[model samples]
Target: MFLSKLALAVMVWTLAACSETSGWNNVIDSHEPKQGESTPSKDNSDTTLASEPVSVGGAFLVCAADDSFEMEAFGCRLEDVTGEKLNSTDIKDGDLVVSNGTQAYSAVAIEGSESFWHWYIAAPLADVSLYTVQYVGQIADILNVETEVQIQHPEKQVSEVTMESPYDDRHLMFVTSIAYQAGQVQNGFNSLASADALCNQHALANGLPTSFKVILSTSTVAAAERIRILYPVYNLEGNLISNPNQFWTNRHLAAVVADKMPSSSEEEEDVTLFEVWTGTSNSGLVKGTETCADWTDNTANEKGNFGMASDARKWVDDGGSRTCESRLRLYCLSQ
Candidate 1:
């Protein structure tokens, strides 16, 4: 049932052209030549089909380090990684490449005397251990042997890799966006299965991984026990919430932010109501019979347990029942 709903969601999103506008494109366009204008001539032959295969050399790690959240482009200084200087003659844009041991990527732009090679992953990968540049013929035939290059900074662990979305986080513990209400969606919402689909939809829309689940609890199940916890929860600002010795509770939430008060300029209206529907308690355990009728009936007069974004004490329970009819957000995490 979940698979069917997910497939339908994917079809709808694809038809809607859900691709997001990324900053990476700006970097790509910076070096692209104008129409009808020829690029600088080099000794390297055009990537055209020839009677014989071409031998492309100087294959070395280009993006040796993990990407940062602020990174608009994924690349490395060629000389810094390979210890060999190169020019456009060594490699050119539009080359087909592989990374992470067989994942395909494309060379989008090159710059700085071949100092850097900007790459675009058609399907963004979590981490790329190595990159292989391929030499092709005019008919797009492989012409020569491939050269593999390892990341220069192999010590850089996956956790250090920053991403544009939580779904892209290496640990896969990152949570994406929250739903605005607790209701059965026509395409599957409110229920745990629908919640997962919504998380995946957000990830797909942002060009990130879709393996996500909701941090929710039913009357009989606990959110913490069901979902695998890899790291402390992080807010949209990338700040850590759940940390060592600290759990996801009203007390912890208030303690973490007590020292760092929100700016006065921060408008309450601008903030998406953090009143997220979590049938679990401050200790990550399911509490009362407040799961919005087991997350199926949004109109049920009974309320569901929820957490407040601004009020730490209210994160788990507000000492009051919130009607199931009220529209609220959901907390989702990737497994």
Candidate 2:
């Protein structure tokens, strides 16, 4: 039903060593430092326990007592749990196994007689403090246990269970690196279609996700209406990149400026100015009579409105305009 800390540690070590020789080993070995270069420290390695946490995309197995019943029905990927690619015949009673070429968890077993079989999936625990082996059995319907089996470490007693989002391979999210245009394009560059293409191209070159759009405004459509509302924008490290609540407010210049500006410099005496092409007002409405001749002409002598990136009151519409020939960065968002 559950594993002891010592047993989990042994399993991890055996599995890690086994992984070094399996096909997956090529993936891990390729990341190793080259000759004359120093290897980075394993910051996440367990200091007290022998077994480390399951890798982000690693696989494991679930087993039970019924001999005739398909072990696959119990929901363990044989290859992922054991590097040998063996079938259920290789598994024995009282074993909690991982597909990552590790030793079976010898301590885990069904509570009752041999005929009364019980099994649990060996999933990675999101919160290590609450449980050493907390299994989520929903990956396969056959492995759905009535209650989760939580094995606590002997050294650390869990006072309360703090539930966190469970790690899932399919649910990963990534933020793109900040990018800029190499040069300015015409205001009517494909009527924002070209601008969006530029954003996607930069993202692709940087090995980032290509699902991005330019944060710009046209005479008929506001920037706020074009992108996602209340989106939780983040930097690479998962830090909030923009104000969540104020991003969607219409024609609210102060709110727009506050949302885009850095929080640390909000009260500074001299704030940084982040001017960008907006052609819009604080209310997200078109501001000037001239918008690069409705964004079609880059040579228009008339000026188009722009906003300050750092000025809270001026971020949406500082009542300023820049010539159509001027070049500036466009804010991009993941769609």
Candidate 3:
């Protein structure tokens, strides 16, 4: 449904206040309140709720339920212990593990330049589930953290429930707000990890989900293999970009952008028409060995593959390659 800009802003604000940690961009919960469970007040008048998110050394967990329409799940936001925002540079999907006492759920990065900035993951919510978020110490010391048994309500249809951000739990995608040169990526290292950091930076800064990976491919790894999860992907506008198992094969509903804020110019905001660094062909495989020397070579002699931000036939690759010295943007997808 279309909402007015003011109403949309208000709804988004309320969702942020209720479903996320205050002053932080990480989204920990989207479930409605249960009996005996407390909800934070918008005015900060509720004395029962904790003033800030309870965190340990590496991160903290906010106990909450899932808002996905299809399943009952639980999720928590991972925040830095220092009370600072966690970015891609700070945390990655590999840095932590979230479990429902049985199987492990892959951590999803929910980063945006306009909203939250932290690592978040969700697991299937059991009737009475005990969840744990353990710091894998890929970036810090290992810490085993667990939560008390959380009682979740039975799953129901969207029509029977009210939610904070109904679609917030779904997989998402976005474009980078800033652009980089081929050789300038990661200070000439041209590592995909560095590009991932840039994506997280933009997502965290823009209040979007932070778990983003660059869509570029190298000689060894295909861009299609970089995406961990294959769920339906949506743009910041909540429009369908790709259905499950068809990301590489389908065209998107609209172009993803860095700025998600309601704007008069939002309709005009398209990043795809510009040059984006993607060494992968339309088939999601490496187009050639011309990956700017694995995105490290920035000299004029070296070249890298690129695509128009608005490619229709080739998806991302436009069958074009440019010198590594050329400045371009990167396509980041949230897994």
Q: State the C-alpha lDDT per candidate.
A: 0.50, 0.41, 0.57
Q: How do all models score by TM-score?
A: 0.41, 0.36, 0.45
**Model 2 segments more than 4 A misplaced:** 1-190, 235-238, 241-243, 249-273
The sequence of per-residue lDDT tens digits that candidate 3 reaches over residues 1-335 is: 55688899998999888765653444344456765567777886653543333233454332335564245544444334322334434445665567666677776655563323244454555332245555553444222244322222112123444434324555677665455776563432368888888777767777766677789888887675565433456777777665432344324445555544332243334444567888876446576787888887888898888776554345577777888787677787776
What are the clash counts of all predictions, listed in order? 5, 11, 25
Residue range 1-335, candidate 1, lDDT tens digits? 99999999999888666443344556655786655445554674444322333333422333333354244324432322222333334344555454555556655544445333434333343322234444332222221224333222222332544334444332233232333456767633667888878666765665556766777888766675556544445554556554311343343333111112122233422345556677876546565778887787777577887776566556655556578877665555655
Could you give candidate 2's per-residue lDDT for residues 1-335 as a string of tens digits? 25688899999999988977796768876785544455555795433423222332333232321223443222222222212222223233334333322333322333333422344334333311121222443233221122112122111111233212222111112211222222245322535677777666655665656666766667666554565432334543444333332232221223222122222222332323456566665434455463555555555475766666554445546676777765444455566
Better of 2 and 3 by TM-score: 3
RMSD of 3: 26.1
Winner on TM-score (1 vs 3): 3
Model 1, C-alpha of 83: deviation from truth (Å): 42
Which scores greater on TM-score, model 1 or model 2?
1
